[model samples]
Target: MAVAAAFTLPLVVPARAAAPAQAAEVAAKPGSPSPAFKTVGLRTQLNWMQAMPDTMPLAQMSIPGTHETMAFYGTAFAEAQEFKESPQKSLTMQLDAGIRALDIRVHPQGGVDGDRLHIWHGAADQKAELGSGVLGPLRDWLGKHPSETVLMNLSVEGTVDPSYCPGQDTASCMSGYFKEYVGPGKQYASLFWAPSVQGSSRAETPTLDKARGKVVLNVYRNSAGNPYSGWGLNYGTDAGYKAQVQDEYKVGTPSAITTKWNQVQAFLATTRTKRAGNLPYYNFLSGTGIPFLTPSDVAGGGSTGSGDPTDPPTYFTGVNERALGFLRTDSGERTGVMMMDYPGYGLIDEIIRHNPTSRAGTAVEQNGQLNAFVRASDGNLVRSYLPYDAQGTQGPWVQETVGATLKAPKMAGNPVATVRNDKTVDVFYRSDEGHLIEAWRPPGGTWQYADFSTSGYAPATIAGDPAVVNHNGVIRVFSRNPANNHLMESVLPTQGSTAGRWEKWDHADVTGAPQIFSSATAVVRQDKTVDVIYRTADNRVNHSYLAPGSSWKQELIPTEPPKGEGKLGEVAGDLSVVAQGSTISVFSRDAATNHLTESLLTGGVWVHTDVTAETNAPELSGSPVAALRSDNTLDVYYRSKDGHLIEAWLNSGSGTWQQFDFSNPVYHYAPPQIAGDPAIAIRPGKVSVFTQSGTGSHLTESWLTTSTWTNWDMTADNRAPVLG
Candidate 1:
């Protein structure tokens, strides 16, 4: 979020004691050997924010102006409210406290003849309390710490003497004064970090190695003649500053401050996700408000007099506390430059914790392997995967729920899984909050949850299960945007600085929920194109897909039946689509008759085909799932109405349908039972089907290899399984 480069009169009364003695121990004068200057063991262990040049304090180091010299003092103006925002410490102390940015507001102290520069806050002179001469100490500090950099933002805050530059104008006079103050033979000659400034529209972040022990000056308002005038860096304009002043006066309640903090958090999250990495992002965490005080109360001696001693502390304290909480929940994402008020009492440390480097090596590694993700009876996402022992022998399939305490009772349908380009497995599910939640395990890394709500594109409007497919390293997600019941697609970044950014597309306009069992399915074709199929709101099957360099186009799957077959009836449950070679087919169950229906995309048009014609096609009790075999043949699995498992396949050469009964009453300890939707996965030479028992108390698995069928109970009391 951009902060207006202007100052307003406000006081942050110190309601708490000073920070611990350790904070003061590192506070040493320039050129002194301080413990804070010591380099840590590793660069990764350091706070990334501290390494960036843009991190800074909100105001320049200044001493409080006394009531006698203060312009607004007396006459109902409380002296306690005058200089509370000014820093009591020197520049040396601020530098040691890990503050790399400095806000220096310079104005002409004497008349046109006077060459001295004095720092002022509004009408009050701060030269006495803060240092009178600022450049000397700042120059000395750079000489001592050659590895640290500081960003000095110089601006003209108050009125400047018109006679300083005669007809040259205020901009020229300010520019001339800055140059003479820090130019060659001046107070800071050969001290400023001039190379840090860029002349291009995009200013690159200076590397630490090049900017070590340097002072980067940013003049907010420079003359046209100045080489650094159009640095292209964003600076607060007069109009923006005026707007901010008006906003400050309008917000008078603590709740307004809370609302502003929420805006800041949202802005921070967006910046973290979309930042270009060329320049640092900054946020001013302070808000202007009088939550505890009103004009009537302040008029009745409530601020200065002890009549209203029971009033709460100033609004600044509340903002600071909220900022601290935001930083904690930010979870180590880079929070650019955070210009803050009262940046003491261990607040710098809290801000530094947001540096990404501080979180290096924190991601749990999952190692290379595919895992099955399913929702357990307890409403927790569970993972079931095969483990290998020391001798390379496969161990029993282990089942464990992820983040056991986190519940997903509102999860719709089954979680979908896909393998990323790096061979890591990602599982996507709808959370109870109607947001897309992803749990992924990187190769050699443990499982990690990528909550889309925080990672950028959060469509809380999602109404049903999401379908995910990874094509050529890009993970694409398709979900129904409940707002319009239109399908929405989001593509994950494949690589580079924008790697984690989720680029969302316009709604694909496929029918979404109100039908609880309806969901979309997607598959990647051989040419890296994507084919998606779903049940429309009219209970008709529709196909939408995207080819390379093309937009998504939709077409009806021709489910109207072949002339005399009558209507196929409504789609009962979720649709499944699979691609084999150049052929793409969709499978669904008829709502009215429970008859499994199939559609083949031939020559860009869908051709409805019946899987069972001569033989009796068992009525389906659940959605049908399809998988392509190694020989380019299709295998379909579904639960039968009699609570038995059935499979259908097509003859590779003749394109004829055949059925196989996997439920054997003699082999089972009890009568064979099946429930819910079945998931299919193809291995090297076999096809595996995972389903839940009729009682929904056990997870069963059936596989077909060669001509033999094997069945076993995988686990108990697990939801419908999703194979990766």
Candidate 2:
């Protein structure tokens, strides 16, 4: 294992651009709202606890958590979380990414006789039963990540159960449920870091070493309407390990977030410098008092509890966003247990980074060989992969389902995929909401998401297809600023920042304003110079290049090239580019003639070929996708005029080009009726293509081997559920 040095955050913090406040309103308004930014998810601190010394007091460390964690299914005013999904799946995402505290409230159903516990948020039912939704997942997480411990504040959410106790023996009645599910001879009971029989030890706070793999219970109130002294750690008053609290949950309105933040910051300052024995500080950052400033608004600054961009921003910045800014500047501070709502936009990772013994970062990486991904009808992303040195089929194998991002209201276009030298796989696309979303997976891990457009990370409003080029480990994502039809770029923050957000620069503009272009494609050379080609609005092809540490250079391909000298060679649709060593290949459709044209870039010279005319290929109906083999042989596939998949191939050494039709019956293979365009992937001995089934919307796949073209495929229906 590599020893990681402590990470220092960048001096300049990235935030949404603040709108200039009107001079007249400065005195009248309580405060001008902070610049608004959308919620972009980052990698969680999965095992930071394992890096901490076991002897450290859990109370002396900073812990990130959610308040009313499962209260997401109710009226907008009652909902407390924005990661909308089933309780188990939502909770697990938080847990895997460094959340250690859970604030759960449950109402006992069927009176005092039944063990069924229903989750609620005041007047609304949250659609979850305790045993299955909350406890089961927690136990499972502790079992898998045994180096961690959980602090749960479980309280009765309703009045019916406690009222059923007849005002006497409420403690005795509650003891029965524990004995049934978590009592003597029950394996679970031993893992509960609670007194065997609560007495004078009601306020014991254990060290991480003593409570590893255990649930440290904290009871808010008792069934008998008395102090919860007999159950576990007393969070109220008058206990040896009593909690020092700062829960200003009723901040009046959304604009009062600054006031609430000042209070939280002042409290944390004291916890780090002062010594109050081993007493823990339970600083609750969750607040809501008005309908407009509900929990959703105060958390991530999104209105209506929806993370999508269609919902308007809450003028005032959210607590989660602000907290992230403050926490990044703090070092080795004991935040105690910092509870919040809508734990996103880098909120969880920022909180865990304050722990003294942590090696916290903003990314999660794993080791795996092959993977596939797609967008589901419900707007979720699914993944499937094969292990290294293993046999596997191209699939819609659906390992993990990444839900709609907080910034994207709707997913649009096909996902563009790439793998870096470090084996990090990423899928980029533009959302129908004019946002650019990146769905990336770490080695051996599931998909994680980030949206560049939401935080004003783009130079202009993003729309249309987005292009990505990876040079070494640095990735550059490009999108056209549809407002002015100018090409723009946002570079990944791979150094000097732990925020994991992409940053945009003014100098990256290719085809500046007033110079209109479409369907831009990018490719990187061995020398690290990037080349981008786009079709001019006038139907001519233009090429631009940018070398490292140099200014942008521009060129135009001759409209009447040598390959199709007597014919018009204007680009009509998509531009697909592939760079092999010293040569670059670009495929496009002729605007005047529906024929596919191949343009090659080599040694600063341009060579053109009309593949459709040369091979007698049928006219193309959809955009074409090109792939390169180890030997530098290239193959391009597109949907034909008659709806069949047509492939055009050419060998590097030979100038000859050939055509293959998957729809031909002579090969005797069953190929699904493919709709739209086709995608290609190649390994050492095999090459494959995937499409969407025109009839039932299933994902269709076809491939070829050494001696003959052979294929096996899977659709979205057959993917195994491997993620929450």
Candidate 3:
């Protein structure tokens, strides 16, 4: 599975749930706002949720006095019944507002001659029926719109009144009724697309195209009696249903509701990961038992203790509001089916947005233009070019498979590339055999390959990606020897020397093993010294360097000690280093907070600073990348917590930092989700950034020209692109 960032949203707990009388008082207040209705229009996308029409409010469908039995149970029971989970709108209304997942509790009652299935909520006062009430209308609507799908979870709930199921076994009767009314033989049978229950695991649910005008019937229980058992997906066990409030009548406090909501969120977090070949995940974001709050409570009811009826508690406004926060924070993890009460309150819009999609990894730029080198899905190295004309107008991006004849395995780490003095590009990646493979192209020439294992005394296995840099005229490639975890260096032959060959340095650093997921970053100082920074196994950022021709030396960048006495938590991701004049700044993500932290190597000491704190931005979602602009100012780019691209820059003159959101305005349709660390290149007034789109993992580029931003979809599924 592709590693991606998980979305999470936070929920705020209210003070308390209002008493029944207080709720009534709040609802009766004059000048109360009119009830809010479902308003999200029909969806243009092809998804079960997007295609269904709105549903009628649950409250409007229930027959008055239907809750008499529950009310007879006492005050607590009666109060719970008052908190109506159903909305006032119809199914079509909810569908219009974006409700795709339906929670139906069918009781064998309310059909013609009193022998039919009716939608039941365990309340006697509520009326139920299959055809005109719910199933029939749903079928009719689906017929009108064949491009949509619905997930209907039919379960036998409430009392099986003999008047409703007069004949055989109740479960079998209900199942037979469903088949007779909505099965393929029915008038709307063509609209029923029974997803195969066998081999359901690993089989992706049909896409919108395949599921259009289809009903994904989920027989929650009594599947043995379901005539359509083999036709639709069914789970023998009731594992998918999660109740937000186990005893709705007892949930009288807002904190209790908050706790339940958190439970649902936690359940989703874990279940999403384990959702392989299982029944679709479903979340019931509605509360039961507490009956004092009605559908009107959502928008009108006041707090219990507060006398001002107009100041109603938020819990009364709608359960959907409580769920919005979670959905907002949901990081596109697969949220199978989210069922809600009063869903039209804009909650469905948020849920629909959390659909997960693949995105491209890191990206790089070359020759002041954007160039991406990716290991294709087929294990081929591919390059994409986004060329800009002399007029500053960008051209269409072109992509080609590079080193196609090599038949290399998919690279384990992002490929790194550097430009030689002859303008040739040298790209380095670790081959499947753990050998460091270098693919280079001479000016307008075909690519050539060199294997380090065959060249010299290089280690047969390298643990991670290699970093390359051009020092004066020599091309130095740095990697980690997996055997001893020691840093290794191999130097490519100088520009035009036919006698020169790739050779490994005789010495290995004693800085311990570098993190397998991190690669060394090399920067050459004006004084001819080469400085390389990497994370050590001890969870410390170590700087290893060679002063001119001096022996290699390693030093740990000082970090703030932990509260009691333990080393700082492990570094979260890779380290980025950039040098301007004599100042070298190293950027890394703090494992504890995921915030961007910086260490300045000035003089001979390292000073630590919290870069994100100064900028007041959220914790970064990916590794950070930095580039030195023409003005000598430092510009850092990183993905924000929301999967949008953000840039923080230092004002060269004032030395103050400012941040900008690069993804919101232009890439809002699909934010630039950094699958890998982003790459940056600078030219005069231009700053080009390359990132992988989280939606499709495609190569995406955004550059700033005179403060204006322009973007391009460069290529698809390339490991973070590197600039050469």
By lDDT, the best candidate is: 2
Off by over 4 Å in 2: 1-368, 388-398, 404-409, 493-501, 506-517, 561-568, 668-672, 720-724
Model 3 C-alpha lDDT per residue in residues 232-338, reported as the tens digit of each score: 45344233223211213233554455555665566566544453343455554445434554322331223444546766434233344545544433322345565
Superior by TM-score: candidate 1 or candidate 3: 3
Winner on lDDT (2 vs 3): 2
User: 151-214, model 1: which lDDT tens digit per residue?
Assistant: 6655555666666568877755665666555544655645665543332221334544345566
What TM-score would every model get versus the actual structure? 0.46, 0.46, 0.52
lDDT of 2 at 186: 54
**Cα lDDT computed for each candidate against the true fold:** 0.50, 0.60, 0.52
For candidate 3, report its TM-score: 0.52
> Once model 2 is optimally superposed onto the true structure by TM-score, how far is the C-alpha of residue 707 displaced, in angstroms?
2.8
Worst lDDT window (10 residues) for model 3? 1-10
Task: Name model 1 segments beyond 4 Å from true.
Answer: 1-370, 405-412, 454-456, 495-499, 509-517, 560-569, 667-671, 716-724
lDDT of 2 by residue, 1-724 (tens): 0000110011211111111111220111112222111221344445556544444677778898778888878777787764536878877877876788888876656533234667788878877766667777888888887767888776666565555456556555555544444566553565577562243346567767677788887654553323455666644454533337677788776658889988788878767655446656778888987756777677656433354667643345677667766664332246878888766535665566455421000111123244555555444555545444335444333345554443334454445556655677777765545577787766667667767777777743564466776655667776667555566777775667633556775432543422335546677765666767766655567777677788777766765444323233656555777665555667887743567887776655566677887789987756677766544567788767555678888744555778988867677232434445665656666665665543334455565677577644455446522111
lDDT of 2 at 151: 84
Decoy 1 TM-score against native: 0.46
**Candidate 2, after superposition: displacement of residue 464 in Å?**
1.7
**Model 1 CA lDDT for position 263:** 58
